[model samples]
Target chain A: DVKVTQSSRYLVKRTGEKVFLECVQDMDHENMFWYRQDPGLGLRLIYFSYDVKMKEKGDIPEGYSVSREKKERFSLILESASTNQTSMYLCASSFRESPLHFGNGTRLTVT
Target chain B: AQSVAQPEDQVNVAEGNPLTVKCTYSVSGNPYLFWYVQYPNRGLQFLLKYITGDNLVKGSYGFEAEFNKSQTSFHLKKPSALVSDSALYFCAVTPLFKAAGNKLTFGGGTRVLVKP
Candidate 1:
């Protein structure tokens, strides 16, 4: 079975604070993704990494950045968090054309 | 651009009753469609996918989806509903030609409520 782990399940931060959400996958998948889920909006992609040091912006990538220094780990960074950034963040990893395996998700609260 | 739509926001059904959750999609070229289920406070779990071949694809936990090219729909169905089957369901689509990376566009999700 594939396992995707998120560093934090829940987090709270003040406005303008820098926040990091870490994800690690044991399956050695080549593609990792970050998404935010909001009520009524579903899940919207924030960023994705296809390989180490290679990142691509998703539908809503504003105020967010990603790091893929290693194949097993992917991190989502909020350079300066805002209240609007508060939401459930999900991390997923997958091989080409394969179904994504997802972490439990990190619910971020930016006050 | 690829997109998926879940028409119903919520679906309520009694246990042992047949259930259907609607999903439709639009994309350039062939469509690679998928259905996922999310329990409370859990990440989305892959339920079924329609890559090609059989129009009716069976998946995990007794769930299945039928792909209709004419209608551009991939609706999920089950013979009988169980209270445990209640969850938030999502439909997603990725263009087949763009298979380099698995970039999927998801629907808003439908909350299924099964009453015992």
Candidate 2:
């Protein structure tokens, strides 16, 4: 079983502050993704990395960035946290041809 | 680009009753379909996927999905509903959606509420 772990279950940040959400996968899967879930907007992809040092912008990548310095870890960075950015963030990893294995998720609140 | 849609925002069902959640998708080529369930505050869980062999695929938790190419739909179904089955359901598509061979596209999602 693949275990995708997010560093925090809940986080609160002050507006305009920078926030970092970390994720690590036990399985050395090459693909890692960050997504935000909102009430009516389902899941919107933020960023994804297919390999260390490689990253791709997803549908909604503005105000966000990502890092993949190590194969097992992927990090999402919010340059400046805003109340509009508060939402449940999910981390997932997957191998080619397989389904994504997800972490429980981190609920970030920007106050 | 590939896209998925869950027509209904919510589906209500009674325990022991058949449960169905509708899903439809559009893709550039052959579609690889998927169903996922998300419990409150949890990440989405893979339910079942339709590749090719059979139009119907069975997955964890006694859940199954049937693929209808003509209708461009893949609907999730269960013979019996349990209170625990209540959750948010999402449908996805890939080539782009597959294992993320590319980008994965998802539907808006449908919330299932099983009443006693």
Candidate 3:
């Protein structure tokens, strides 16, 4: 079984604060992704890493950055958090061409 | 670019009745389609996937999906609905070609409600 773990289940941050959302995967998968889920938007990709230190922007990557210094870990960084960035953040990892295994998700509330 | 669409925003069904959640997709090459269910406050859980082989694929929790190349659709189905089945369902797609990368383009999602 594959396990993806997100560091926080719920988070609250003030505006302009630098927030870090961390994720780690037990399986040695090559792909990891960060997504934000809103009521009508479903899950929009924020960022993804194909390999350690290799990152790619997804559809909505403007307000975020990502780090993949290690294969097992992927971190999403909000350089300066805002209320609009609040959503249910999910971390997922998968082997090449496989279905993604996801963490429980972190509900972020930016105030 | 690959894309997926779940036409209905929500689907309501009575318990013990059959349920279907529709999904359609577009991609330049062969598509790798998937269905996932997200429970309240939880991340999405994989339900089924269609890579190749038989068009009808069965997955966890008695859910199944049919892949139709001509229609470019992969609609999810279940024999009977349960209250526990109420959740948000998302359809996602990725191109079969490696050049497209492993990124999945997801649909807006369909909220399933199973009423007793």
Candidate 4:
């Protein structure tokens, strides 16, 4: 079984603070994705990286950025956290035409 | 652009009974549809996907989904509902023409409850 590890399960941050959420996968999958899960909106893609040092903006990437310094690791950075940014963030990895394997997720709370 | 829709917000069913969750979608070209389930406090788990070939796709945990191209629907089904089957379900889709890194568009999600 593939294991995708998230650095934090729960996080609390104050407004205007910078937040970094880290994810690492063991399968060496080339495609990594970051999504924010909300009550009614389901999961919305925030950012994704297809290779190290390569990233693409998703539908809702206004306040977020991503870094893929290593093939196994992808990090999501919130430049300035706000109350509206409080949500569960998910990390997923997949190979070409394969189903995505996801990490448990990190719940962020910005107050 | 591609879009997925799960019409029902919640579906209540009894154990041992048939379970079905409805989904519809729209996309520019061919659709790559998928179904996922999320246990509480957990990330979404891939249930099944319809890429090509047979319309009926069987997936993990005894879950199956049928792809209907004419209706633009991909509905998930289970022969018998188990209490453990209770979870939040989401239907997702991506355009076939896109590259490998294509991101999926998800529905609002449907919560399933199986009673004893």
Candidate 5:
């Protein structure tokens, strides 16, 4: 069984504060992803990493950045958190052509 | 660009009744389609996928999906619904590009309500 674990389940941050969401996967997958889930907009991709220190911006990468310094760990960074960035942040990892295994998700509330 | 669409926002069915959640996709070449289920406050769980070969793909929890090439549909189905089956389901499609790094295009998701 593959296991992906997120750093937090719920978080609250003040406007303009820096936020970091961490994720770790036990499966040694080569691909990792960050997504934000909203009610009507669905799960929009924020960023993804294919290899260590290799990152790609997704559809909605604004106001978000990601780091994959280590194989098992990936971190999402919000340079300046805003209310609009508040969302259910999900982390996922997978090997090529394989199904992604996702962490439980971190619901962040920016006030 | 590749995209996935799950037409229904919500599906309600009685327990023991067959249930379906519709999904359609658009891709340039042979598409890899998948279905995932998410419980409240949880991450998405893989259901099944249609990569190649057979159109009917069976997955966890007795869930199956049929990939229709003509209709561009991959509708999820189950013989009988259980109350525990109530959850949010998402459909996803993989792009044809190898450089895409296995990123998945996901639908908005459909909420399933199984009533006893």
Candidate 6:
């Protein structure tokens, strides 16, 4: 089974602080993705990486950035965390454009 | 450009009764459709997908989906609803909505409520 692990299950940060959410996959999938889930909004893609150091912006990339320095790890970075950035963040990986396996998710709260 | 629409915000059903969650999509090329379930405070889990081939595809937890190409719909179904089945259900289509890429475009989501 594919296992995707997020660095933190829950996190709290103050407004204007920077935050990082890490994700690692054991399957060495080529594609990695970051998404945020909100009530009535579902899962909206923030960023995705197809290969090492290769990144692409998703629908809601306004306040997010991503890093894929290695095939197994993907990190999401918030330049300046704001209250509006508080949401459940999910990471996913796939071998290609195939079915994705998702991490448990990190609930971020910005105060 | 590709997009997916989940029509209902919520679906209520009695335990042991049949259930259905509707989804429709638009894409320039053949679309890869998927259904995911999210329990409270948890990430989305893959329920099933319709890539190509048979219209009816079965998946985990006694769930199944039918892909109707003519109607541009792929709806999730279950024979009997269980109390544990209450969760948020999302339908996704790839590539992203209004983009010619490989990312998935998820519907706003549908909350399923199974009453006892």
Candidate with top TM-score is: 1
DockQ-wise, the better of 2 and 4 is: 4
Candidate structures ordered by TM-score, highest first:
1, 4, 5, 3, 2, 6
Q: DockQ score for model 1, please?
A: 0.82
Quote the positional error of residue A83 for candidate 1 in Å: 0.5
TM-score quality measure for candidate 2: 0.96
Position B71, candidate 5: lDDT: 96
Report model 5's TM-score to 2 decimal places: 0.97
lDDT of each: 0.94, 0.91, 0.93, 0.94, 0.92, 0.90
Instruction: Please report the candidate that would top DockQ against the real structure.
Output: 1
Model 2 Cα shift for residue A21 (angstroms): 0.3
How many angstroms is the interface RMSD of candidate 2? 1.7
Stretches of candidate 3 exceeding 4 Å from the true structure: none
Predicted structure with the largest lDDT when compared to the true one: 1
- A-chain TM-score, model 3: 0.99
**Separate DockQ for every predicted complex:** 0.82, 0.65, 0.64, 0.70, 0.66, 0.53
Candidate 6, clashing residue pairs?
none
- Name the candidate, 3 or 4, with the larger DockQ value: 4
Q: Which stretches of candidate 1 lie over 4 Å from their true place?
A: none
- Tell me the lDDT of model 1 at B3: 87
True contacts recovered per prediction: 0.72, 0.57, 0.60, 0.60, 0.62, 0.57
TM-score of each: 0.99, 0.96, 0.96, 0.98, 0.97, 0.94
- Residue A42 in candidate 5, Cα distance off native in Å: 1.9
Off by over 4 Å in 4: none
RMSD of 4: 0.8
Give the range of the ten consecutive residues with the poorest summed lDDT in model 6 chain B: B94-103
lDDT of 1: 0.94
What is candidate 1's lDDT per residue for B2-99, written digit by digit as tens? 88889899999999999999999999999999998999998989998889899999999999999999999999999999999999999999998876
